[model samples]
Target chain A: MSIKNEILKIEHLHKAFGENVILKDFDLSVKSGEVIVIIGPSGCGKSTLLRCINGLEDIQSGKIYVDEQPVIQGSKDLYEIRQKIGMVFQSYDLFPHMTVLQNITLAPMKVQKRKKEKVEKEAIELLSRVGLADKKDSFPRQLSGGQKQRVAIVRALCMHPEIMLFDEVTAALDPEMVHEVLQTMLELAQSGKTMLIVTHEMSFARAIADRILFLDEGELIEEAPPEEFFTSPKTDRAKKFLQTFEYSKK
Target chain B: MNWNVIREYLPLYIEALGLTVKIGWLGIILSIALGLVCALILYFKVPLLQVIIKIYIELFRNTPLLVQLFFLYFGLPKLGIRITAQTCGILGLTLIGGSYMTETFRSGLSAIDSIQSESALSLGMKKHQVFFYVILPQAISISIPGFMANIIFLLKETSVFSAISLMDLMFTAKDLIGLEYKTIEALFLLVVFYLIMLLPVSLLGTYIERRVRYAAYGD
Candidate 1:
C-alpha cells in the first residue's frame, strides 16, 4: 500500500463546557482519501471531536493541524482554514429563504469570491450527482427530510474542502430516508474523498470505514479495521456497545 | 352632519393629508433605518454602543410620542436649539419609532435558530458574511409582522404632531372646527382621511406577510 499524505492531525486535545468535560486528551490523524468512522454511545464526545476539528468549538489544550496549518478557534485564519473543511450537520440546516441552488452556491460565491455563473454551474452538477437536479430551483421547505440532507451534503462539497466531516447526518432522517443519504455518502467515499463521520448507523459505518474507532466516556477505547472491530472488539466496553445494536435489530 | 361645511374645508383637509403622509412615511423610513442600526449594535453586543443604544431605546419607548414632540419642538427652542415643526415631528417620530423598531428587530434576530449560523460559519463564511447572507435575511422575514405593526403605530402617532403645530390631519380638523364651529363635519372628515392614509398600509402589510410566509414555507 502506498503511504498517502496526512491531511489532518490532532494531539492531546481537551475541551470542556465549564465543569462538564466533553473531550479529554483526544488525538486523531487522517491521511488523504481516508474514511474514518467514529462510533460510540450518546454523549461519548463524538460530535464534539468533529466540531473541535472544524474550529467550531474552542479547545482547552493541545493542537489540531489541517494540512499542517493550525486550527485555532477565533484565530485570524480560522475562516480560511474552515474553507478547507466541509461539515454537514444532522439538522440539514439549509437556508430556508434560499433555493437549493442558492444555498449550495452562496458560500462559494460570497466567501470564496468565485464567479456566480461558475458556482451555479458547479452547484447544479453536484445537485444532479445527488439526484436533486430537478429540485435546484426548489426552496428547502419544499423538500423532504432526505432531500434536504442531500442538498446540505452538496452544499458542503461545493467548497472543495480537503476533508469532509459528517456529524450524525442520517440520525435525524426518517428510517426509510436514511438509506438514500447513506448511499450518497457511500458514493462520496468511493470517489476517495477524505471523510470523518460520526454515526450510530453501525452497518453503514462498518461498510464505509477504512478504520473504525470505538469511543466511550470521551476516550478512544478501541480502534481496528471494521471487520475486526465488529467481530472482536478489543475492549469489553466496545463489545457491550456493539451488543446494543444487536438487540435493536431483533 | 353639515355637507356644505365639509365641502368648504375639503381642500384644506386634502392639503393636510399630503403633509401628514409625507411626514409620517419619512419618519417611518428614518425610524426603520435607525432601528436596524440599533438592533445590529445590540445583536452583536458592540460594547459602548450597545449600552448607549439600550438607554436610548428605553428613553424613547417609555415616553409618549406627544411628550417627545413637545420636548423637541417646545423645550429645545428654549435651550437655543430651534428646529422647524416639520423637522421636530420627523425627529421625534424617528426617536420613538426607532426604539420600538429596535426591539422588534432584536426579537427577530434572536428568534433564528443557532443552527442556522453554525451551518453558515462551517461553510467558511466570515462572521459578517454569515450575518448578512444567512442571518439577516431570515431575521428580516421574521420581523415583517412586527415591523408592519410599528409602521401603523408610527403613522397613527403622527396625529400627535398637531400638538407641535405641524398642521397634520388632526390639526386641520381641529383648526376647521375652531374656525366654523362645525365639529361633526370636521371630525368626520378627519376620520375619513386618516383611514384613507392607513388602510393601504394595513392591506399591504397583510399582502407582504403572506408573500414572505409563502416564500419561507411554501404554504
Candidate 2:
C-alpha cells in the first residue's frame, strides 16, 4: 500500500543477535492514523520489529523517523521519542507495585508534570473506557489477564503516544479473554491513533489491518491489504503460510 | 543480692544508655544513607561510579568492625589526625553498617522492575525524578526492614566502643565491675541495658516490614 501520508518511516532497519539475523534490511512506512498488522510464524522477528519501532530494540544500521524527525539514529531524545511512540508488550509490562489508577497516571503526572486533578480525571476516564473504572485502586496482581492488558493499553495511551505498537498482546491471555483485549485495540484504532499490531489471530488482523505484512524468517514475504493478502496471497511463502493457518480456527 | 546495690550506679546506667543510643543510632542512620547511595551507584551503575563504590563497599564491609574502630581511633591519631572515641565509635559503626547497607539495598533495587523506570521516563521525568518518584521510594520501602535489622546489629556493635575507652554502656559496666568486684551484677545489668535498647529496633523493623508489605501487596 502507498504511504504518502506516512507518520513513521522505517528505512533499511537491521538487527542481529550473535549469529542470528532477526531482521535484515527490513523496512516499512506507517501512514497517519493507519492500522498496520504484522503476522508471521514464531521467531520471524515480528515482535523485534515492533520493539525496534518503539526504541526498545536498537537497529544495528538503519534509521526510523517519526513525524519527519530521525527518531532511531541515536539523535532524538529517548524519552521524548518514547513519549510519541507508545508500546504495549506481550507481557503487559505494568509496574507490579502500582495500582491500576497509579499505573495509568504515573507517566502523565510524573513526565508530563500534569496537574494531579487533570491526570486523575483523565486516568479515571480512560479506566472507565476500558470497563475497568472500579479496578482503579486495585494492584496489578489482582486483575485478570484481560484487565491488565487493557490497563497496559491505557497506561501507554496516557502518554498520548502518536504511534501505538501492540506486540501480540492477546497471545498471553486465556483464549476466552482474548476478545476483550482485541475489542479494546479495535476501539483504540477507532480513536484515530496510529496502531501497529503484531498478532497471530488472522480474523483480528483481517478485521482491523489496513495493510497486512507477513514475515517469515525475517523476510517480508507479503505486503498488501488484508483482503487480497489473506485471500489472494501472491508469493509462494504467503500461499504456503496461509495454507498452514491452523491458529485461525480457534 | 539486693536491688539497692545497683541503685547507686543508676545514674551511671542512664548516662551510659544515653551514650550507647547516641553513638548507635547516629552510626546506623549515617551508615544506611551511605550504604544506600553506594548501592544505588553500583546497582544502576552511573557513569564511572560503579568501580569507586564497589571498592569502598569491599574495603569497609570485609574488614572487621573492631579493626575499623582501631584504625580510625588509633591509626588516625598516629597519622596526626585526632578525633574523640565517640567520633571513632560512630564512624566505625557507619563504615561497617554502610557496607552491609549497600549489600541489602542493592538487592532491593535490583529486585524492582526496570519497566518502572521506563514507565516513569515515558512520562518525561528526568533521571532524578525517576529515582525519587519511582526507584528510591520503592527501594527504601523494600529495604527498610533490612535497614532496621542492620541498625539492631549496629546497636549491638556499639558495645564494642567500650574497647576504645568511650563512656558508652559497656565501658561503664567495666568500670563498675572493677570498683565493686561484682562481676555478676555488673554483667547482668549490662545485658539488661542492651535488651532494653535493642528490643525497640527489632520491633520497629517488624513494623516497617508489615507496612511495606501492606502497601505494596495489600497483605
Candidate 3:
C-alpha cells in the first residue's frame, strides 16, 4: 500500500466544562488507513477528544480538520464534515424505535438521499458482514450488548465514512460479549479502514493500533508504537495505567 | 323502580351522550396539541415563551377546573365573548388537560437518553432531523402511557361540563331526576352510560401502549 496523507488533524484543542478543564492544547494527526488507539484513565479527556473531533462537543479553543476542511463553528454545513466521519459510542445508541435495517439505512436514505432499495441492499450486505444478517428486522432491545455494538458499527459503516471513531465501544458489554465486538473491529482494521479507537483493552490495542496515545490529566503524555508502548512505557502514568490490566490478568 | 321513566328519557340521554362524546374527543385532541406545543417550548427552553408557558401551566394547574369553567362560561360572556356552553366546556377541559399533558410529555422527553440525540447528530443529521427523527420518536414512545392516562382523565373530566348546562350526560341525568323524582334510576343510567363511553377509550389506550412498548423493545 502507498503512503497516505493525513485524513484528520487536531491542533491546540482546549475544552472545558464549567471551570473544569478537560483537554488542554491537545494535538493529533491521523493518516489515511492508520489505526490509532487512545487509552487513558477515566475522565482523562479521552472520550471528550473523540467527541471534539466529530463536533459532538465544542472546544474552548482549537482547530479540527477533516480532509483539509476547517470545522465551521455551529454551521449548518457541519453535517458535510460529519458525514465523512463515522462514530460508535460506548452505549451503542441505536434508535430503539427502528429495526436494525432502519438504523443502518437512516442516514443514507435521509441525508444522502439515496434510493431506499439501494441502501437496503447495502445495509443487508453490511449486516451480513458483521454476522447480523438474521437480525435486520429485529429491534435494538432484542439484541444483546455485543450484538447492539456490532450493529452500531455497521450503522456507521453504512455511511461509507473515510474515518471511524470508536469511543470505548466495548466498555459497557458483558465480558463474553466484548470479544465479538473486538473481533468485528479487528476485521475492520485489517480491511485498511482508518480507525481511531478509545478503549481499555490493552491486548486489542496492541494487536491493532499503529500508535497508542496515552493521555493523562487532560494532556497527551506519550505517543508511541503499540509494541514499544506496551513493552516499555515512557511515562510513569502510562506504566501505572498498564499495570492495572496486568494485575487483573494475573 | 322507575323503569317507565327511564324508557321515556332514553332519547334525551342518548342525545346528551352524543354531545358529551363530541366534546370529550375534541377536548382530548386540542389538549394534546396545545400540550405538545407547551412541552416543546419548555424542552427547547425558548426565551420569554417558556416563562409564559410555565405560568400558563401553573395557573391552570393550581386553580380548580370548576372555577375555570365558570369563568369561561359566565365571566367571559360578561366581557362580551359569548360562545356556546359546549364551547366553554371544551375550552375549560382543554386548558386543564393540556397542563397535565405538558407535564407528562416533559417527563417523557427527559426519560430519553441524551446520547440518542448526540448519536443522531454525529451521523450528520440536521438539528430538525435529530429532533423529528430521533428525539421526538423516542420521547413519544416513552411518554405514550402517560399520554394515554391523561386522555382517560380528560374523558372523565367531561362530567364537570354539566355544571355549565352543556346538556352532557350528567346534565341530562339531572334533568331526568328533576322530571321524574327517581334519583336512583337517573344515577344508575348515568353510571352505565359513562362506563360505555370510557371503557372503549381505556381499551384503545392499552392497545396503543402495548404497541409502543413492543416497538420500543420488540418483545
Candidate 4:
C-alpha cells in the first residue's frame, strides 16, 4: 500500500466538566482511509473524544487539527471545519418535523448553498445506497429504528465529509436492527472513508478497524492491529476488558 | 327583554364588533412580534437584554391589564407622553400580552431537546441556521397550542379596551345601557358579539393544535 497523509491530529488534549476531568493529555493521529475503533468501558471518554473532534464539546488545554486547520470552539472557521467532519450519534437524532429527504437535503442546500436539483439528486442516490429510497418522503416517526439510523448515515454522508465520526451509532437499536446499521457502516468503511468509531460491538470493531485503541479512564491504554489486540492484549486492563466481552458472548 | 331595542342597536353592535376585532388582531400581531423577540432574547441569554426582559415579563404578567391600560391612557398623558386612546389600548395589550407570549415561546424553545441542535450543528450549519431551519420550526410546532391560547387570551383582553374609552365592545354596551337603561338588551348584545369575536379563534386554536400534533407525532 502507498503511504497516506495524516488527516487528523490531536495533541495533549485536556477536557473537563467543572471539577470532573474526562480526558487528560490524550493524543491521537489518523491518516487518510484509516479506520480507528476506540473501545473502552463506559465513562472512559470514548464519546467525548469524538465530540471534541467535531467541535461539539470544548476542550480545556489542547489542540485538534483537522486537515491542518485548528478546530476551535466559537471560531468563525468552525462552521467550515465542521463541514469536513460528519458525525452520527447513538440516538439517530433525525429532525422529527422534516421528511427523510428534507432532513438529508437540508444542510447541503442551506449551509453549503448547493443547487437544489443537484443536492436532491445526490440525496436520492445516497438514500438508495442505504436502501431507503422508497422511504424518502416519509417522516422520521414512520421509520423503524434501524431505518432511521441508516437515513442518519445518509444525512451525514450527504455533506461529503472528509472524515466521519461514529459515536456508538448502533448502541440504541434493537437486536435485529443492529446488523443492518452495522452492515451499512461496514460498507462505508470498505469504501475507504476515514472513520473514527466508538462502539461496544467488539466483533464489529475487530472486523472493520485498521487499528483498535483501548481506552480506560480517559487514557490510551493500548493500540494495536485488531488481530493482535484481540489475540494477545498487552496490558492486564485490556485482558480483563476483553474477558468481559468473551463472557458475555458465551 | 326588548327585541326592538336589540334590533335598534344591531348596526351599532356591528360597528363595535368591527372595531373590537381590528384592535384585537392588531394587539395579537404586535404582541406576538414583541413576545417572539423577547423570547429569543431570553432563550439565547442576550446579555443585558435578558435581564430587562425578565423584569418586563414579571411586571406585565403580575399587573392586571386594566391597570396597565389606565396607566398608558390616563397616567402617561400627565407626564407629557400623550398617546391616543386607541394607541394606548393596543400598546397596553401588547405590553401585557407580550409578556405572556414571551413565556409561551420560551417554554416552546426550551422543550426542544439539545440533541436536535447538536444534530444540526454537526451537519455544518451555523448557529443562526440551526436556529432558523432546525430549532425554530420544531419550537414553533411545540408552541402552537400555547400560541393559540395566548391569541384567545389577548382577544378577551381587548374587552378591557373600554377602560381607555376606545369604543370597543364593552364601551358600546356600557354606553347603550347608560343612554336608554336597556340593561338586558345591551348586555345581551355584548355577550353575543363577544362570542362572535372569540368563538372562531377558540375553534381555530383547537384545529391547529390537532394538525400540529398529528404532523409532529402522527397521533
Q: What is the TM-score of chain A alone in each candidate?
A: 0.97, 0.94, 0.96, 0.97
Model 1: residues with Cα > 4 Å off, grouped in runs: A1-4, A248-250, B215-219
Model 4, span B94-169: residue lDDT tens: 8998999999999999999999999899999999999998888889888998899899889998888887788988
DockQ rank, highest first? Answer: 3, 1, 4, 2
What value does the lDDT take at residue B188 in candidate 1?
A: 95
Clashing pairs in 2: A111-B123, A111-B124
Lowest-sum lDDT 10-residue window in model 1 chain A:
A1-10
* Candidate 1 chain B, run of 10 with poorest lDDT: B210-219
Q: Model 3: residues >4 Å from true position, as ranges?
A: A1-4, A248-250
Name every residue pair that clashes in candidate 4.
none
User: What are the per-model C-alpha RMSD values against the true structure?
Assistant: 2.1, 2.8, 1.9, 2.1
* Candidate 1 local lDDT, A26-90, one digit each (tens): 88889999999999999999999999998989999999999889999889899998999999999
For candidate 3, what is the DockQ? 0.82
Kindly report the TM-score of the first chain in candidate 4. 0.97
**lDDT for each of the candidates?**
0.93, 0.83, 0.91, 0.92
Kindly indicate the candidate among 2 and 3 with the higher DockQ. 3
Q: Candidate 2 on B22-125: residue-level lDDT in tens? A: 88889888987898688878877887788877788889878888888889988998889989898888889988998899989998888778767755654455
Estimate, for each residue in B1-219, the C-alpha lDDT of model 1 and write its tens digit: 878887888999999999999999999999999999999999999999999999998999998888888888889989999899999999998999999999999999999999999999999999999999989988988999999999999999999999988899999988888887898999999999999999999999999999998887666
Q: Write one digit per residue (lDDT tens) for candidate 3, span A1-250.
A: 3324889988899999989999999999899989999999999999999898888888889899988877766976689889999999999799999999999999999999999999999999989998999999999988999999999999999999989999999999999999999999999999999999999998999999999999998999999999999999988999989887864432
lDDT per residue, candidate 4, A1-250, as tens digits?
3324778999999999999999989999999999999999999999999999989999999999998899999998999999999999999699998999999999999999999999999999999998999998999999999999999999999999999999999999999999999999999999999999999999999999999999999899999999999999999999999988764433
